[model samples]
Target: MGFFDRIFGRRSAGIDDPEQLRRQLFDAAARGDLSRLAGLCRANRQAVETHFPAWQKVPEHLRSDPAAMQSHVQVLVAIAQVFAQQLGDASLFQRLMGTPRDNPLMRWQDALRQAQERIDALEFTAARELLTGVLSEAEGLQGSGVDELLPITLGRIGECHFESGEAEQALPYMQQALALCEQAGDADGVRIYLGNLFEVHRWLEQREPAAACARRLAEMIADPTAKRQRLRQAERVAAGEPRNRVLAVIDGASYELDELPPLAAGHVRFMFERDRITLRRATAANEAGEACGGEGEYAEALAHFERAATADRHDPHCRYQAAFTLLHLRRYAEAESAYAEVERLAPGWFHCRADRWLAGRLAAGDVEHDVFLAVHALQDGPMAPDEKLDLAEKTLTRAPRLALLHLLRGTQLARLGREAEAVAAFRDGLAGDGEPDVRSRLLVELATHCDGPQERAALLRDAQAPAGNLVAAATAQLLARGSAN
Candidate 1:
C-alpha cells in the first residue's frame, strides 16, 4: 500500500507498480529536467537499493525491455551522473545508484568528459579516440541503460569530424546520432540536429536529401511562421537554380569544379533531377508565357513556358500551359507529348482552348473578341443549329455569367426558328451584363424575334449606338421593315 512497500515487491505480483515511479524519473531525465529529476532521485533513494538487485536478476533477454524497472533505474542513474559531471561532483552517480565509483559505468563517464575537453581544445585525434572507445562500449551494452549513451557519444564523434572539415566522414555518424535522438524522443535534440544534417547534405551537393530534411523539419516544428518559411526554403532547395554550380567532394568537404574527380565530373553530364515537393509555387515565367502567346510571340512563349516547366516538373499548370503554347507554335507532336505527360501527372489544369477557338471563328467580323472559358466543347463548324444550341446550353451550366455564350445560344435558337425563345435568350444575354459589343449584338438579334413592329424598332434603336457595324446593320433593317409594313 505504501510507496516503499510497493517498490520492494512485498506482494511480488506488484512488481509492475514501481515501474510507474521509475518511468516518471526516466521521463524527467529525458526532458533535461535536472531539478525535477534530483527531487525524484531523493524521494526514491531507498527504492533504488532494492530495485538495483531486482534489475541485476533480470534475464539478459528481459534486460532489453525499455520499460523494465531495471533499465529505467539504470538510465536514471546515467542521467544523474551526467549532471554530476557537469556540476563537478564525483559522488552523484554512486550515491544515486548505490554503486562504487570504480565500475565500467564510471570509466565511461570520465572518458566522456575527457573527450569533450579534447574536442574543445581542437585535439580531434585524441577526442575521436576517446569518444569512439566509449561508443564501442556503449554499443556492446545494448539492451541496458547504456543505450541512452549511444547517440551522445556518436554525436560528439560526428562533431569532431565535422569541425575538422571531414563532413563526408562525419555524415554516417551524424545520421546515426539523429536517428538515436529521434528514438529517444528528445525534441530539442532532433530540431537542432536536423538543421546540422540539412547543412551537411547541402554541402555534399545532395539536394534531394537536403530538401527532404528541410521539409521534415518544417512539418515537425511548432512555429507557424517558421513552418511557412521552411516550406518556402524547402521548395527553393528542391527547385534549385538551373545549372547550379556543382562542387567536388574533398577531404570530407566540398571543393570547386577545378578539383572535381573524374567520376564526379562525369556525373555533371547526367541530367539534373528535379525534387517533387508538395507546396505550390507561382512560376513567374508562366505569366510571361501567357502574355507572349497572346501577343503572337509563340516561339518566345514556348521558351518561357519551357523554363517554368523545367523549374518545377510537378507543377501541372506550367506543364499544361506549355502544351497550350506548343499547340499555338504549331508543334503538334511536341504539344501532344507534353499533354500526355500532364495527363500522367493528374489532370486538373483546365483551359477551354477548343471553346475559345470555336467562339473566335464564329464571331469573326467587328465583334469585340473576348475570351470565354467553358467545360463543354462547341464543335468546330458544320454543326447543325440544334446541336449547337444543345452545346451552348450545356456550356452555360458551367459558366452562367459568360455573356458570349448567351449570345451564341440566341443565335442558335433563331436559326432553329424558335422566335420567342430566341428573344428570351437575347434578353438573358443583356441582363447578364454582357460587354458593350456583345450586348449590342444581342439587342439587334432580339429585335429579329420580336412579335410587333414597334417592339422590333425599339430594340434596334438601343443596338445602333455602340458597335460600328451594328449601327449600319440596325438602321438598314429598320428601313427595310418599315417598307415591308
Candidate 2:
C-alpha cells in the first residue's frame, strides 16, 4: 500500500507499508508490547529516526502551533511510558535526538528536557529508564555533550531516590551533580542543581550546607534576563560562609535562625517538624569517628562512633552506626545494646535491625540464638510480621541499589500474607545492582519459594554464604524444606 493509500484505507500498493508499520509499532509500544517494539525497531530503524529525527528541537516560537505542541506532547508521553515499562529497545527514541545508528540516544539535550518533565511528574520508573539509557550511551560518547548529560543524569538519580522516600541517600547525588555542573561551566544546569542541592541538604538536616546553597543561589540570581550569563558568571561569586544565624522555619522554605520569612502558620509548623531533630552536637570524638570511617580506619571509626554513642545515648544515627560498626568488629554485646537503643528511640527508621540482631545472637554462640535460627530455617516458615513490614518500608525508602534488601524484605512479606507489598518490594529490588552479599542473601531468600531441586541448586549457587555459619545453615534448611515440598 502507498502512503496515501494507507491513510485513505486503500491497500493497492506497498508504498504505505512503512507508515502503516510505524503506526502499528507505536500502538504496540502504547500497549507495552516489548517484543513487538523490539522487532519493529530492528527492521525499520532508519524509518523510525527519519520520522522522529536525531534532535526534535521545538523552538520557543512553536508554542502557539497547536500541531507542534500536540506532536511534542505525544512523543514525550510515549517516550516516558517506554521508560517506565522498562522496555527492551529504545534505539528509535534515542535516534530522534541525533544519536549514531549503532549508539543509543544517551546524551541528547532534547530528550533530557523531556525526561526532566517526567521526573517532575513523579514518574521515576520512566525517568530512570531514560537516564540509564543516556548513561549507557554516554560511556562511549567522548564529546562535550556527554558532560551535559552527566549532571542531569545524576540529578535524576537523586530524584528517583527522593521520590522513593530515601531522602538521606539523595543528598550525595544532588551535590555530585551540582559539582559537575560547576566544573562544566553549565550555568543554567548549576543553578538548577543548586536548588536541588539545597533541598537535599534540608532533607538531611544539614542546616549549614542548606544555608550555604541558598546563599549561593541568591548570589546567582542577578538578572532574570541574563540567566545564561549569570550562570556562567557564578564562578566569580564568593562561596557562602557559614553564619551563626539559625532560623527554624521563616517562610515555607527552611532558612536561617535570625530572619523569618513570611510563611503561613500551618506551613511553619510542617517545616519545623520536618527540619527539627534533637541530636546532640557532634563533638571532637564524633568527628574523629567520621574521619576514621572515611579513611578506611574501620577499627578506629568503630571506637569513635562507640565513644560518641556513649557520650550521647539519645542520638539515634550515632547509636545505629555504632551498633553496625560493632557488628563488623564482632562485639555482640555492645552491638545489641546500640541496636536496642535505636529501636527504642526511632522505630520508624528501620534497616535490617532484626537480621543484625539475629547475626549478633548467633555470633554470641548462645543456645537461644541457635534455637531461633533453627525455627526460622523451615520453608515458608513464619516470621514476625512487624519485622517484615519494617524491612519493606526501609527497602522502598532506599531503592534502585539495595536490591538484596528488597529481595529479603519482599520474600519475608510474601511469607506473611502481604502479596501486593511483596510484589512492589521485589520489583524495586530488581531495579538495581546490589552488592555481592546482598545478592547472595536475596538468592537464598528466593530459594524458600522454589520447589524441589531448584531450591537446593539456588543454595549451592550463593557466592557468599554470609560470614555466619548459622545464617548459612538456616539458608540450607530453608532450601531442604523447598525440596521436600
Candidate 3:
C-alpha cells in the first residue's frame, strides 16, 4: 500500500473498471452533481494512477473511448469543485489538460492555459508573446464573453509586468480582477487573482497587506475545494504555524503539524545556500526532509526536494536531489539531470563510483563520464542529533567502512536517545582491524558517544601502546636501507 493509502485508505477505493468509472465521472460532471463527483473522486483518487501510470505515461481512461475521453476533458474543466480537490496534483491536471493538436478546441484551451503557466514560470517575454497570440485569437472569437476573456487577459498582463519586476504596476490589475472575481463569486478566479496579488505585495515589501492576503488564502485552502498540499502549506503559514513538521511516521503516517511563522531568514539561507534562490520554499519549509529520506519516505522527500529544485535556477544540490528523487520515483530521464548534477558537483561521490562500476552495464553514450559532483547541503554550523542521523544514513549507505562515518552515526544515534545502537556501532568499529592512529581516534570518538568515565578509560587503555615501545621493525629496516644507500 502507498503511504497515502495507509494514512488515508486503500488504493482500490472501489470504483473499479476505468471505462465504467470514466462514464460515471463524466455523467455526474455534466449533471453538476458535485457530491456525486466528489464521492467518485473520494472513492478513487488513485484512479488517476490507472489513467496516467506515471507523469509521462499515457492515460488509459482517455484511450478507452472518444466520448469518454471528451467527457473526461470536459469534466476536468467543467467541475470546478473537482479541480479544486485535485489541485494537489497540478502536474496531473496539466497532463490531463494537454490534448493533441488535432483537437482544436482542447488544443486552443491548452495553448492559452500553457501560455499562462509559462508566465508563472517567469518567462515573461515569452509568456507575453504567447498570451498576446492567445488573446488576439480569443478576442476574434466574438462570442467569448467578457467573463471568459477579461480576467485571463488582465491576469496574464499583470503577471508579465510582475515577472518583469514591475510589482507596482502588477498590483492594480490583479486587485481589480480579484474584486471582480469576488463579486462574481468565482472561487477559483478569486484564488488566481489573490495569488497574483499576494506575489505583488510580497515583492513590494508590503508585509502587513501580504500577510492579510496570505491569511485569507490559508482559509481558502481549508475549504475541501482547495485540497492542495502547497496551498495547505501556505494556509499553515497564514494560520501562524510556519515551521510545520511533516513527519512520515515509520508506520506510514505522514504527520503534518501547524506551529509558527517561518523565518524568512532561514528560507533565504536555504534557498541561496547553494548559490541562487529557488522559486518555492521546499528547502525552507521542510528542513526535516533528510530525516524523512532515511525512513523510506522517498516520495514525500522527493516532493519537497523537487519543489525546491523547480523553484531555483538550477542549483546543483536541488538538481541532484531532483534526480535522486526521480530515480527513486522511477522516472529515469527526469532524474538524469539530477544524477548529472551529482556527478558535476562531486565527481568522486559514491553514485559516480557506482556509475563507473556500472559503465559496462550501461550504453556507451549513457556512460559519458565517471565523475560526479559533491553536494553537501548540511547546515554550515552545528547539527541536531536528528539531523546528524539523517546525514549518517544517507552517507553511510555509500561510505559504510569510513571510521568517521561510524563514529558520527554512533554519536547521532546516542543523541536521538538510541544509546544501545550507538554503542554497538562504536564498539564494532573500535574492535575491527585498523592502524594505531585510527585506533586512537576511534577511542576518542567512543568516549564521546559512550556514557561514563569507566568506558572512556577502557577505550583509552585499548588505544595505548606499551611505554617501552620503539620504532616498528619495518621502519627500522627502512632506516638501515636508507643509511646503506
Best by lDDT: 1
lDDT of each: 0.61, 0.55, 0.52
Question: For candidate 1, what is the total of clashing residue pairs?
Answer: 0
In the range 1-485, model 2's lDDT, one tens digit per residue, is 56744433322222236658656755666676555554554455455556554324454775667566556546545643444343355654444444444434433565577777876665666876777676766664433455666777788888776654566877877888988888878898888988777666655556667766766776777675345333322322223322111224434444433233333434432111223233223244577776786666769888777766654444466676666666656567777777767656554233434545444544666324323323233222354756655644543453335454466667677878776777666556546554343445455554544445654475545623543222333345434444555
TM-score sort, best first: 1, 3, 2
Q: How badly does each model clash, as a count of residue pairs? A: 0, 12, 17
| Order of candidate numbers by lDDT, starting with the best | 1, 2, 3
Better of 1 and 3 by TM-score: 1
RMSD of 2: 24.7
TM-score of each: 0.35, 0.28, 0.33
The runs of at least 3 residues in candidate 3 whose Cα sits more than 4 Å from the true structure, single-residue gaps closed, are: 1-124, 132-144, 158-170, 203-205, 218-404, 407-421, 424-485
**Tens digit of per-residue lDDT, candidate 3, span 68-187:** 555555666543345455434454455554564533345456666787677655567787776666656555232224455567667877777665656688887688678868877889
Model 1 scores what on Cα lDDT? Answer: 0.61
For candidate 3, the 10 contiguous residues with the lowest summed lDDT are 267-276
